[model samples]
Target: MERTGTMKTSKKMMHCFLWVLALSLIPSAFNGCGGGGGGGTSDAPKQSNNSEITVSSNQINFGSLVANQTADNSFTIQNTGTRNLVIGQISTSGAPFEIVAGSDHCSNRTLLPNQSGTIIVRFTPTANAVYTGSFVIPSNDPDESSLTVNLSGVGQGLNVTINRVDSSVPGNIRMIVSVTDANGDAVANLPNTAFTVFEEGEHKPTIVVSNADVHPVSAVLALDNSGSFWASRLEVQNSAKTFLDQLRNSDEVAVIKFAQVIQLAADFTQLTSAAEINNLKAAIDAPYTDSINATLLFDAVYNSVDRLILRNPNNRLAIIVVTDGQDYDASTLLPGSTHTLDEVIAHAQQAGVFIFTIGLGADMHTAVARRMANETGGEYLYPPTPAGLNAIYTKISQILINQYEITFNTTKLVGTLNNLHVIVDDGTMQGDDAISVTY
Candidate 1:
């Protein structure tokens, strides 16, 4: 009986060993047949069922950009996956670099398998410097959940401003041109011959002189302290003060405040001393106790031009009008009205007085201001906000100081109203501005 039992136990052991060997071989068989062997390993890489993201470029170079100017570029994003790919938030890291609006196709969007889209980026440099930033893109990519595109650019410093100055000489037209670097500093090294002037009928300048040699200026500040500007009175005062501070000591300024009536706050006075400038600021900041019933816009401008023409006909004459409303006094029902638009424009042209108008708010008549400026060879500026007034005033002051006075004897030119065109070229840069003269 003991021998029989030992033989049976040995047979049982052999059966157990065979069963274990068979289980191992079964997995190998399934793997070789490409079956679903959950516990088996393969030498080949496993294919993922999730989405994958790819980009056309990893970096963007904008090269060089001018301060306050904008440049743009674009890139493509693709989905190489069997399943749908979803893109999430997209953002830029720097102040100047920005993702252009309506240009990002992947933001909060879904892309089907093998689909692609484009994204546009823009750069606007406010100052001169090397700018660096990145665009961060988040997506449901298995390998890369987030992607970054490096951005780089350099800002250049160069800007040119031109303004016309009134001249009493028959056929003589003057221009105040300034070249500023990125830092807003004047560049004085440019030669006088760099300027090329053109008349309406002719292609060349009669005569051009770079006023790099300083000259005196006669300017008038025609301010509207009317009801419309009451709320922004402080801003107007500050802007006027800032304008005065920027003028040269040799420049003469006059102040005219117009509301229901025009008041000569300060007569034509030379801003040669700090006390004179302070007195002018005080006059500007003075209370507007007068009634704000009407705005004597055209009349005020006419009177200011008359004041400038009477005081200094030989120097560069300019009238800067700051107003927030149109000429309501022209209705004939109002009092203290003296001149019409046509009269003002005629007087300005005859006297060679340039009119620079600054319309403060949307309520101001842009067309009238633009006409006045265009007729007298001046500029019209409408600042979007009160904060921009100071900058505009500073720019005008710079133009006044760094002007190019062009004088040519027009004995042959015969006309009461002559068309004048001026061109300045420094080989690389050029500027063209026009004016009308009554000789």
Candidate 2:
């Protein structure tokens, strides 16, 4: 009987231990289908399950972009799972650079498992400001609910300016060129730096460029309308036209015509059109019928120089006088309105106005004309006949081509008359370095 009772108890104990083992195994089986494995969770992101998409680069970077220029870049999105991955939203940080629309920005786009599509990116910069931003892509997958793209860029500024200099000693005009880089800093070691001067539509030669600081220039053209000059007016007209043709687009030109009353044919206008200059030449050649008895030569010179005093307070001034050189009667200038011939010479010297005199004949007050020319640091030329006038015109044209303007900083001037000397360093001129210092 006792042995039978022992057997029953043993069986009951075995059953109890078996029940505990089964409970532990049940938990292990549930864990295998629950959250322990890579793809166990129902909402877990998985490339193999087609629930997640992969981007080649989470951030796009554009190093540097220049002002008024553009730059571009792109990336790709791939699906590595069996399910479709849909990107529901894309957001970007709104500072610095901007987000330009790309193919991925299109609505309702989906990537199939094991297939790939593109997410193009673009950055546009405005002004010279530095910028940085990011783009975020949100999706249904829990692992990659948000994909962030980083961006950065910079803009460089540009610079521009106009520089003028005085090549004129007493009262002349000259310009300087000093172009700057994008940073407003002057470019170093620039080649072929030059400034052009113009009046109306006429082109003057390039002004000699030395330093970009202050350039020096002194120039003037005086015209003769004396009765004797009338005979060669056509030649004079041609000479004037040729001279105007050689003018640079930036230089200043003053036209003077003298007989009794000195007339300013033109003043300080840019030469932009040939027609305008031709019109001026026609007007200059128009007939003047008064008797040859009144050539107020000294008065004209004085007037031209005096006018320059107002035009430029500190630049060296020059006068080109076209005349017959006959001091027939003179003295038409009102008292206090002008100076005597000697006084005009002295004033020109004091003011540093160089006078270049063109005489119509050696028979018509040649001595006086030559003297005036010499006193004012100028030359006197006699044309004699109409054909001679044309030759004279050619010679004068050559001289004008050789002319340049010097501009000095007014801050360097004492406002008193100062001596000016020009030295050209062109080695090709052989031994002829002695430049005629006009003014």
Candidate 3:
């Protein structure tokens, strides 16, 4: 009975030990499904998806357009990342450059990953010149927040400025002519065949052409300071000042105020790199006290022409006269008005001076103004009101500020090296180009 009791006690001890072992394994069994087997979450934070943007091209060129004419070009934008891209706005900085929203599919729009949108741009220039600008696309791309595109174009037009004729050696005369596109850019590589020299009803027996773009200009800005002008004196002053600011270095200017009297407001002041443009503008403001009622338009023209002849005998010369009425000095015997319209025209032609006429009001002698400008190979402009004067001045300054002189010695530059200035304006655009040689 003792032996049987010993075996039973041993079996009971074994059963209790097994129970404890099984309990310890229960925790490990739970851990086995979520630990080394790799079936559980990590303690680190999750990563979010990101977006990226790309542009097909960073540059867009319009090539060329006539002044006031427009052209368009397009570029592509794409979302190349894992997430969507949101473009907020499209903007530009500069004149003549703008977005063509009607054809633009990208601005203020959302794009899915791997999707692309197109943006169209337009260029329209108001003047003949080289235009530069840039447009920017603002977006929600993490890598690329904004995309910038550069824009460029040129404007074309035609102009011919002439008759800075120098004849110090009798008939051995050399005349300067500036041939430019409507945008006022110089035309190059033109032969003497481009010009015709007519003296009174006669063509010259000889002609020659050369590049004289560097020849200095002696100009006269004859402004109206009469009673009619009193109504717009401040506007006139500001406009005249703006005109002086446009002149190139080495250009000499003389200001004259015309009314019943022809008074010299400023002497020939040479504008240079060192001189302030305001100094010239101040001269225009200082001379205006108020003007007399009489308009001595012709006498003023005569005086300006005569002064140019006396001062710059062998240089490029011009007389820019702004008047509101006809030559009252021709009709009346005024102290300050002595020269007649016929006398002024004759003297201007003899001196090889160009007379640019600007007619102000309805009382302007249109025939006289036209004659002065046309006869002297200068442009004639009629500004509807005084407010348009600054723009008119700018147009005139563009011509005079850039001129070329082609010399002729009694008839022939035959077989000699000559400059060829090419200018073209088909109304939509204007352009000029040239190459030079000895004349």
Candidate 4:
């Protein structure tokens, strides 16, 4: 009996041990089955080494150097990666700036993990300038496909910015310009002796710098009061008043309101007078009350330019035409303007008038208006809504008010394309501008 009992106990102990061992081996078998053998998607990330790029600085100032006098500067690029980084071409823009060949170790080279390279730059300029430009760095960095580094350098002082070029008169070419020094400050109080003018590369002997910043301006304001502006009337009038208040005392401004018929709301007058400004506001605020629903945009622009020409041709003339849509007067049921778009542009060009156009909404005839502005040396602005017209008017007024007009006598034949180059020397520092105009 004792032997049988001991045999039963041994059998039970062996069975229990086998069952526990099998349970432990079951997990190992499941683990052994997962060795990247699936054809489906895996949620794990790639284990490949990724190349990274880090720059020491994004800006390089080469300081001031002489004209054609070359200076050297450099920036460092480091690779914070686990793999090799291959860099591509490095390109730069703006004049007198270039990359020094055989000296750039960062471009067209392989940078190993934790390695650094250098980008060498050369500033060999032709004229004195306060130059600002940038260069692009392309690499095999996963996070950064490319990077732009800003670069600035100064060469002596002369860098001319041409504000605009105009044909103010039949025999004269007018130029508006401003000069900046090496420090980028406007150099003021320059004289006629400070400027040298050239037409078609031939030096002109008669260069008179007249119409200083305080010079008077003659401008006409053309506001759209058509069917398109029915919803925007109050906003339009408010913006027009804002423009009227900003003009200088010497500006001869006219207010022209046009719907189906163009009306000279207020004739040419100076905004410097309180009564003149009030008159312009009142004219702008007057009700149309007519059932005519058409826009004579082209005619308004044409008549405004004509009014400016009739006022005084010597002063700077500009026409600010604000509209929301195309001209619909020709097809209207009411009497309207008869001038064409091409004729208006031609007249403005011949009169040397700048037509600054403001397109109010998305449906505005901006393409045609832009052409009028571009051909007449004016600007076209599209304010998303009418409320933003104040800022645009402020910009236009400032530009027209504080301009220095330099008139040069040119013997070039009419309708000939003439390229004019001007260099204005502010005694010590100088700047230059290049312009092409058919006169």
Q: Write the per-residue lDDT of candidate 3 for residues 1-439, one digit (tens) a residue.
A: 9999999999999999999999888767977866743334455554448777889888888865557656667778998877889998788886799877587798889999899999778898878789999999999987668878888988755555554455455436566666555443446665556555554334554656565546677889888877666788787788877877787777788988877777788888888844556666777887555446677777778888878977756567888887764655333445345766778878887777888788787667666677788677676777788888888888778676556565545443433444434343444444544333223
Predictions in order: lDDT: 0.75, 0.55, 0.71, 0.75
Residue-pair clashes per prediction, in order, are: 1, 58, 21, 1
Please rank every candidate by lDDT, starting with the best.
Answer: 1, 4, 3, 2
Worst 10 residues of 2 by lDDT: 427-436
Error of 1 at 94 (Å): 29
* Candidate order by decreasing TM-score: 1, 4, 3, 2
Could you tell me how far off, in angstroms, the CA of residue 231 lies in candidate 4 after the best superposition? 1.6
Residue-wise lDDT of candidate 4 within 257-288, one digit each (tens)? 88877787888877778987888889889886
Query: Per-residue CA lDDT of candidate 2, range 186-205, in tens?
Result: 33332232333332223334
TM-score of every model? 0.57, 0.42, 0.51, 0.54
Report the error of model 2 at residue 380, Å. Answer: 2.7
lDDT of 2 at 75: 67
Q: Give candidate 4's error at residue 332 in angstroms.
A: 6.6
- Candidate 4 off by > 4 Å: 1-173, 176-197, 203-211, 329-337, 409-417, 421-439
Considering every candidate listed, which one attains the maximal TM-score? 1
